[model samples]
Target: MSYIKAGTDVNGNDVKLHYIDQGQGSPIVLIHGWPATYEMWEYQLAELPKHGHRVIAYTRRGFGNSSKTWEGNDYDTLADDLNAVLETLDLQDVTLVGFSMGGGEVARYMSRYNGARVSKVAFVSAVTPFLLKTDDNPDGADKSVFDDMVDGIRKDRFDFLQSFGKKFFGVGVISHPVSQATLDWMQSICQLASPRATEQCVYAFAATDFRQDLATLKVPTLVIHGSSDDTVPAKVSGERMTQYVSHAQFVEYSGAPHGLFVTEKERLNRDILAFAAGGTVEGTADRY
Candidate 1:
């Protein structure tokens, strides 16, 4: 039930972010993807601590137990919320990990804050560089795709989430990476978020360009993406990220989906542990 005040909303009411701080060592801040709470890092929270790394994950302003605010769902405010966590905890030499939409926070935070308090970063199935396809960014997803997402949310939020969760974890008739109960649990977590925040964040992650922000990453970086990710294609985000941060170590989870955090948790944990410890990650370069 620990909380950190992330400024205030339009009504000047304090926007408190519920967070989980556990373990003790060099810190790792875990940012959950869209439509999820800090609870999404349940596996990491348990495993990372066993390895002696302090892990912190927080619910975003409009999600979970955090204050449901009408504003501040943008990347700028989201990055500031991350800053609040780092500052409040007085963490140093940290490894910041962002997944899916959470990756935008890591990218924006580095650029906006000049990489303060962090020595390394990792993007797992992230939405970065840019997601919305423009005339200049032909490799990005078409705007209509995101438009449909927003429309779906508006028309039937819960139904959309139920469907989205399946695609997220690569759960289909022939391929069930996660159980039905797991999907149910995830949907429950998504329901904890404010509908306004959920809808607004779609626009944020869809349209926000992080190309300039990627240029600001001077720290050690790791990029992991599933080759089968349909949510945020690696070709668009993770693959393009290495072009920006040329020194980043990239790993492609062969046949993995966007929800590799769950489907490939053991491998993901190993890679993260290796990278955080400054050890060589056992993987080949991008093989596409």
Candidate 2:
């Protein structure tokens, strides 16, 4: 129930960000994905602490219990908000982990603040490097893909989320990675977010390019993505991250999907714990 003041909104009102700060040794700050609050890290929050690590997860402004401001949805402001949390808490030698859209914040923070207070970073099923396809960025997804997302959200947010949730966890005809109840719960959490922020963030993650930010990473890095991630494909995001961050350990989860955080929670937790402890990460050789 802890909260941090993340600057002020356009109307000069204070914008408070709700965060969960727990556990006691080496800090690990988690930034959640799009349309999700800090609650998404339910398993990690419970597990990481028992292993002697402090886990801090916060709800991005306009999501969950945080302030619902109409602006500051872009990466620059989002990174600043992240900076506020790190500086306010005065955390040091930290492990910053970003999931899905949260990865963009991790990448931007490195470039924006030069990796202050961070020693290690992990990108789990993140949307990083870049996402929109241009003539030069051929591997990027088509602009139309993002366009449709915006249109869908604007048209019918709940309906779009319901459909998107299925694809997020790789829920197919025969393959049910997550139960229907889990999907329903996720949708309920997503529905708590401000509709304006939800729609605006779609453009932020889709259009913002993090290639330069990725190059600025100097700390130990880990890139983990699913091989069958249809949301943010491995080829365009995680696979390409290794090119910029030459020393990063890349691990591809075979047959996993975008929501690997939930679908592969145990494996994901183990890998993150190993990396945080400066130990050898499992499946580093299984790069796809």
Candidate 3:
């Protein structure tokens, strides 16, 4: 793992993103979500290379050990940072995978960067299409919901994260398949993120609309969500995402929670490998 200067953001703040590249063959750049770093994809990092696929995971600005810039927590800059990573490496025919807030980065990358050098995209327990409720977005969440989240995070980031982590993994909210140690592990990683960045990102992912970005995605796409997701519910996110992307395959992990990547590692890994190999994906997936 190395930290490379990814160039300054729009605000002229110099930012260095931490990233690691491994294995050979086509590249797969995995983007993580709010309050998380590239390390969030540790499982993929360890396994994908063994299967003949290069795995590249990077920490976004303000997350993990990356430079914590005060400005630019929205999707536009986040997406730009991701594009910069792939461009720096001159990687092509790449499969971009984004989880949670990273899903917004994937959409923005396609629309903002024109999907240059990108062949495929994937969303795992993502937040996409439109998350906030407005006059036009009737199915989205209430304004107060997001407002309260930002308030709570600003008030006490650590405490708020402690509560958010439960819903994130669906511990008591649903039947989560992880031990307390696993939950603690996730929290430790989250604690590494800058509190301000974490707070601002709640607004970025919750309020930003990616409907147009979804339309811009022309390549093959994969959507995976836990049926019992509580953080970003399947009902609001992946379920509707299947309708947005042009050529997309959807996977639902029954009884799995928001952190299905941990709760259902074996199954999730199999699906990821199959998709990366360009194998025929079932048009639709029944619950796991």
Cα lDDT of model 1 by residue, 1-288, tens digit: 799998888898999999999999989999999999999888888899889899899998999999999888899999999999999989999999999999999999999999999999999999988999899999888889988998999999999999999999998889999999999999999999999999999999999999999998999899999999988888998888877888888899999999899999999999998999998888847432
Which pairs of residues clash in candidate 3, taking residues 3 or more apart in a chain or in different chains?
none
Model 2 segments beyond 4 Å from truth?
286-288
Off by over 4 Å in 1: 284-288
Full ranking by lDDT: 2, 1, 3
What's model 2's lDDT at 283? 87
Give the per-residue lDDT digits (tens) of candidate 2, residues 1-288.
689999999999999999999999999999999999999999899899999998999999989999999999999999999999999999999999999999999999999999999999999999998998988788888888888998999999999999999999999999999999999989998999999899899989999989899999999999999999999999999888888888888999999999998999999999999999999998895232
- Selected candidate, larger TM-score, 1 vs 3: 1
Best by lDDT: 2
Q: Could you tally the backbone clashes for each prediction?
A: 0, 0, 0
State the lDDT of candidate 3 residue by residue for 1-288, as single tens digits: 587677886688779999999999999988987887787787878888888888899999988899888887888988888888988889999989898899999999999999999998999999998899999888899989989998988898788878887888777744556678877788889999998798889899999999999988888888998888888888998988867775677888887788777777777777888888888554356232
- Candidates' TM-scores? 0.98, 0.98, 0.94
